[model samples]
Target chain A: MERPARTESPTIGELGESRTLARILPRLASGDAALLGAGDDAAVVAAADGRYVVTTDLLVHGPDFRLAWSTPFELGWKAAATNLTDVAAMGARPTALVVAIAAPPTTPAAVLEGIADGLHEGLAALAPGAGVVGGDLSASTVLTIAVTAFGDLEGRAPVLRSGARVGDVLAHAGARGDAARGLALLFAEGTDAAGEPDPERAAEVRARHPELVAAQLAPHPPVAAGVAAARAGATSMLDVSDGLARDARRIAEASGVGLDFDGEALGADLRVAFAGAEDHGLLATFPPGVEPPAPFEVVGRIVPAPGEVLIDGRGIDAEGWDPYSGWDGRSG
Target chain B: MERPARTESPTIGELGESRTLARILPRLASGDAALLGAGDDAAVVAAADGRYVVTTDLLVHGPDFRLAWSTPFELGWKAAATNLTDVAAMGARPTALVVAIAAPPTTPAAVLEGIADGLHEGLAALAPGAGVVGGDLSASTVLTIAVTAFGDLEGRAPVLRSGARVGDVLAHAGARGDAARGLALLFAEGTDAAGEPDPERAAEVRARHPELVAAQLAPHPPVAAGVAAARAGATSMLDVSDGLARDARRIAEASGVGLDFDGEALGADLRVAFAGAEDHGLLATFPPGVEPPAPFEVVGRIVPAPGEVLIDGRGIDAEGWDPYSGWDGRSG
Candidate 1:
């Protein structure tokens, strides 16, 4: 039989963002015991014996990261940080990771080395010996890194976002706006009268609150806290990816409940963390009757009301950065 | 310190096949536990109590697949088949998969739906409800798919390619050479009676061997046989990816042993399936003392001799189809 003419060919950009996925999905068959695979925040691969954890995240350099702002090592660290936090959000002990990178043929050996260095530094800080496993290197114009992390459940049922209930006390275990602060600093430096980029200023921000700029560049998610929260009987959990306000909304919607934030609970300095977007900082909920685990700070409360998020008794838009949305304010 | 200008960049293909993985190792701090990560066919992910299996492969349109020869659904199946087989090679039951795709924006929703259908179809054959959990869609020139599959060990030790020992029985399950046959038909049609493009012949061939053509477009891997081999104590496990002769060479190199094949044992009617390629069959090695499981045909045996692969008692180059290598004899 003669093959049909190809009238559905899409343009390059269209091909990149949309058509390819549409073209490839029909071939997949159902899998065994995979509760949630593909099409969400992470892939949930089932582990027998009461442990179900997940690992995921993809970063495209030109689209996801930029050399104008981030070094290769920083990019590597962020790669590990984002995926590690996903496992952490499930309240699992992170154990291993696999990294696959696609880069231009012209990518420098040193840059690749820096990426590995950053991955090592970032992952080492959270889970020792949880190094990079399998990866692929292919030629492309821009850089793409896909990472899959693995974790141990330690005999606890995974704390899922859907488990939150009304009347749950919401608590957080890590600083929030540090990465955002560093980003603000970066924008401030970029727009300064000198109009020159400063490596020193960037380094200083990273040093003072290694948690801040590093949060932006390479967030070190509080992995221990996630496991602790699950053990402490936290009802629902999520790692902050988009933003506190945005991520909290996900849990709220998933649990069919409303979340109320107490402005007073977050110290003034910590409130600044909300201004920037980085990666997994814990936001967990426990039954209203229980006290939060050690070192956790009360940030909000889950309410019976469905589909609403309130801060200081006022509604806030669940807006965060959308890569496709244009930034009208940043142009010269 | 001022960062230096990037004047030196390595080619993607060069870095991909490079053997100097040690030189690429980065400095580390502590806490990461990525034991035995990159530099392997599949990275070992450490689970707390049970073992998990994994495999990954990337498909680039125009390089590994072509839109002219395949529909979107077929492309989807091929992508899934390639990676799923890798998990099967580990002798584990496939559980979930994650697919990352890059394409242009003008793609139709139906195409994506078709792709999803194909993915679901393949997954349904193995395990139901297994789907893509999370994936990122971005813009790129070519349609590229990066798929990662996860499997469960079911309390069995993973069968590695290195486990093949002297005096082991080499066996295979599933079809072989169908894809290669389809390609030959295509090639023959392209070069017709007058040594010119044979578009009509190509059409006729496509009609005659729909199965062979489909095999080339989307292969059906013997996922179950892999688990059966492991359960039956197969010493080494591997899926036939490149070609029988070439993949067998990898087993030999990894095991530091030699393999002897009997042409007669490969199946008297092997050519009836298809004469050339695209048969993603399964190959495994078991202890010499073990009996061949049902459905597994003993085609060869592992030998004490180290290095080199012999087919029908002769040393023949096992190199498969590589665009750069320019049409080796088998491609015709």
Candidate 2:
């Protein structure tokens, strides 16, 4: 079926803020985190262990995603997944989320409702008990989603990036070169004659490269593995947001140690696995004798030289991954 | 000294994301709330007694504020204040904030730094010990700020808008219709010939009405009054963001009661006091025999009628506020 023009659907402005909220709020109430959720001035969530981990992330139109290429469901799922990974990176269980979304008044109400459904489904899949506790909505020329996520430590100490020690086993999970590879394909074939991302072209690319496209649109990060790593006595950890080399460099600098990667362990596409961005993988270092839980593949070892990151005795380029030379899928 | 043109200053695009963040992050580290603050995947904050209240609010460029009228400092302060009020209304002591900011790449780095300074100062003055925990920066066409606040309930049950009882005393603190009145003044005399908000004209208006302009720009909402009201056993509470009549109607509907106002207690400008929005005031109801907090000025009483709101025995217009009739200071 052909998608109707934006004008065919009722705009948020025509329905007004109150009615729009009434339409969108119901779809977002997926399960409960604790004491309170939505329809109140503020939401009360369980901290569980006296401490809660907090993080915020923003997604803006153009720099973040193209509406023409990605549906509102994808955008919302990405937004929720983006923040949940941050919480998981802290070795905490995601407890709740509060989102602030701003869109043009002319936006279709269905778009917002679809986003809400995505948020609900994403949380249900990634962090079962976590829920959208509260949210704010407003109008802007550009569509934007700002999410603040909360997580509980469950009495475990937070794993900091500065805790990796010399001789620690460097490990990773849920990351490969796939997301960035998929992104490269999209840029190469997803645009129309005018070089603008077209829905049909994007669909064609997705059909041809299903895994790659899905990786970019919806890479399921190992959220629960974070707490497992913490339980397994992992020393340090972080979410591989930037390319491997760049993010690994962060652990090197923070831990005041060197990271020596084992080339054979880095997958078939070594450079892509090391340089691909937005994989949302868990990178950690465990004490030599502390065997990591399942799914954490050993990638390297921590070394004595402070702030040095090398793969098979050679330093990787500073701008590790160059999958899409012009657009890095971060800020424009 | 005159402010330099945006081009004269180093733009974020030129400075780069890392450099702009380095310039802004330092100003945001006002004080430590607990285990972690910024510079990590997520921040860990203390949620004493195992429960925390969360709320988020967004501020968009044209709908919420105009650059020509509000400096980056004022905008940031307003953003922080806006979310802080929501938390306070929950009868919680704000403990931390996580913000997501999006702006054009061409924006001056100084503007972001100033906003960071404002976020720090606003927190210091309004909710001490509440520091920015984590944040995200992205590029967008319209400048936007989204703030999510965390508050501790301090072992007290949360105050809800639906707890009002018949014959309860309706009291308010901080709100007085001044912000809307000042906004009306700005629209009337502070814009240039093009009807666009202009700096010099806004400055002139501010100079002429210092109190009114300050009310609009930096409303010192009695943040502590909320906790005090909660401690005093207030039955219901809310922050008056949408004017008295409308918000009272919300409380009335939620509590299944009516609100009857006392004109004499409403203040010198009764209509303005009742009709103004963005006052960020604490509006609460006390049980019939319970004494209210000191700062909570009695404004009216709760009655038996369901969802009816009146002032001096007459129903107020549904559009309680007419100040800046064309601009509601909400969504565009």
lDDT of candidate 1 over B1-332, digit per residue (tens): 11221335332222221211222222111112222233211122334335555555556554455554565677667777767777777777676666666543334434444455566567666444344443444444445667777766677766777789988998888777878777666666635665543546655767888887767776777777877888999998777756777677778887988877877886554433323444667778999789767667898888876666765666556555332222211211
- Note the DockQ of each predicted structure: 0.06, 0.56
List model 2 lDDT by residue over A191-232, tens digit each. Answer: 878677778889999999988887788768889988999999
Deviating ranges (above 4 Å) for candidate 1: A1-50, A181-213, A266-276, A289-291, A323-332, B1-49, B126-142, B181-209, B264-279, B289-291, B320-332
Query: Can you write out model 2's per-residue Cα lDDT over B188-223, one digit (the tens) per residue?
Result: 888878677888989999999988887887778888
Q: List the residue pairs that clash in candidate 2.
A: none
Fnat, model 1, is: 0.05
> Native contacts retained by model 2, as a fraction?
0.74
- Maximum-DockQ candidate: 2
Which stretches in model 2 have alpha-carbon errors above 4 Å?
A1-8, A320-332, B1-8, B30-32, B320-332
